[model samples]
Target: MIPASSGTGLPVAVNGIEIEVIRRGAGRPLLFLHPGIGIAPEAPVLDYLAEGVEVIAPSHPGFGHSQLPATMTHIDDLAYFYLDFLETFDLREVIVVGVSFGAWIAAEVAVKSTERISRLVLADAVGVKIGDRTSRDIADIFAMTDTQFAEMAYHDPRVGQRDTTALSEAELLTMARNREATARFGWIPYMHDPKLKDRLHRVRVPTLVLWGESDRIVTPKYGRAFCDALPDARFELIELAGHFPHIEQPETFARRVLSFAGEAGVPVTAVKRASA
Candidate 1:
């Protein structure tokens, strides 16, 4: 059991799986959904957001320390599960923030849930399948060198540090399992929903599509497509960053996210104070 940090730990059953959730800070709730692979909401990128608003970051059923179901399949299940999660917590008027695969789930939640979401921030998100453009396949990504992985996953090379050679066997196995599970959900054709782009028009909430200008993995073109689909959305590109700009450029990331959160009516501090 990973001990709770700032947010209290709560277990909620979704589709028979008990999902571990961490709630931190105070004020309007902002649900943070993490990307697949080694990324977790507890990562530094998300930790910065916790300082401003009440943040709720849940480990997807098959990632992090969360329980993985024996027969879980497809990303849609995750979307439905999160809808139930919000209902279970009686969370209304929420601001949804999702990164990478988490952003896909957030989009699904926005579409499927009956509850109202005030705003959405999809950063380096993948959900809609665009024609002609090829997305980074999971199998291909795993075969890349650490430096190559960094180049594909981040616009900035600094966020690509990995020293897994010293990891224990158990830790390595766990990582493998997480990757396998992620593939199961995210490996569909085009790495996105073929119909999702058309469905974006249905979402009534204000949306902000954030992208790393140097993101070669998903490409910034897709980001513009995502922004174009939303009825009330705009796109912003983070310079000197890559796929995971939030991590590579935390201060800039936090400022932009907080600015969007503020516009979405999430009560929080003014601009984030720069580090000394």
Candidate 2:
């Protein structure tokens, strides 16, 4: 059974598995696919987006406290699950925002069907093979020590510096589960879907390939190539941020995302401040 903490999102069964989802604000629905670290709507980026557009944040099965079913092991499966989610909820002309691994999921979802997604944003997304075969594709999150991962993932390493002594057993378990799920879906492909680049050309939705200029996990160069593959996409870079610009610079990230999503007038300052 998934731990009670997964209750952060209302439970909804999809693809023969129960998915934890939380909705915030009230307006046109905006589906937010969070990073592998899991969805916690309290994050400032969600709040800011919520101020203007309804934000639907869900914990991917196997991450956070969400139920991990035996059948769901690949990223492609997740893309299908979210496709069902959109249909189940009857959401239309939706805006989908995804970051990091979540961005990869969003890409997979977009390529399969943009029927529900009108505006798509992939922030420092990883999931396409690009550049010379000899070049490093993506930094292995599994290989990096926690500290090292944070250093490469965040422009300010201290943002992820943890005081292990302070965490309860439940907190530790949640962290472990998040890591396990990441490895389960992302390890074998080592992050890129060999065919995703080709499928991207079929996506007709307005797309923004947003990247943290300092991202070490997947560099901006890769992001540009990812953008170039899409028929209707533009690449935008965020400064002073690494892999997770939404965490390091919420205001700037929100501004860029909102602008692209057609909510540029939304006052970013009013939303409660939080993190990824």
Candidate 3:
């Protein structure tokens, strides 16, 4: 296992799988699960969150420097893997925050147990089946070209653009690994778990469903449906954003989360600002 680094990340063995995790800060313990695109060492949202809480952001196995166990082939395996993580770390009352594909895994984890989780936040999440068999709730990201995906994924497509030529070989390889891992789990079912919708009721903790106001990948309408399925949940939208609100509106996103978590110094006005 790799030694712990202060702000970057570390390789820690969980269930015999070495997963790279970024951990920092000190108030409340918050477990952040990244989107299918994976988490960068300098993701602004993580910095925002870490400023207020102890943010534990892990690169899902197979998505970064993490070791993917050959036996772990399904998202359910991920759900279970996280449960073990919480237990291993002795973390409790964690504010579990997930975005996009990560939110899907958070939902799965919540369905099984809320014993360790206090509040749940799912931002632009895609995992449940809320429509008929003939309907498509999520965009077919795998089939879209890079340009098409960027257009669909961001309100301002330019925000999603990357100068690949500027990236180091390691950065490029991590991006490729993230794509392969996303397709490995989500491709077969086209992103939704058929049984997940029915099990959402099992999530007893209060949930905050944050969606991008302009997300074409999984429209706000779909996000509302996801919220409605939860017993104790409220829906909020981040303006001028698309599929990844955490990236597009990190300040607002972080403010809303801190408000929801009732973090000690966060002003009550933050809630009003977030809604504004």
Better of 2 and 3 by TM-score: 3
What overall lDDT, based on C-alpha atoms, would model 1 receive against the true structure?
0.73
RMSD in angstroms between candidate 1 and the native structure over all alpha carbons = 7.2
> In what order do the candidates fall by lDDT, top score first?
3, 2, 1
What would the per-residue lDDT of candidate 2 be over residues 1-276, giving only the tens digit for each residue? 122332257777775677778777777778888887876656888777777787788889888767877888899988998898888768898899999899999999988888877888999999888866877689888888889988888878898788877999988888889889988999887887877877776676778889998888899988988887777678999999999888888888878887888833222123211111
The TM-score leader among the candidates is 3
All models: lDDT?
A: 0.73, 0.81, 0.88
Backbone clash total for model 1 is 3
Instruction: Report per-prediction Cα RMSD to one decimal.
Output: 7.2, 7.5, 5.5
Q: After superposition, how far is residue 23 of candidate 1 from its true place, in Å?
A: 2.2
TM-score of each: 0.85, 0.90, 0.93
In candidate 2, stretches whose alpha carbon ends up further than 4 angstroms from where it belongs are 1-7, 263-276
Clashing pairs in 3: none
| Cα lDDT of model 3 by residue, 100-143, tens digit | 99999999999999889889999999999878888999999988
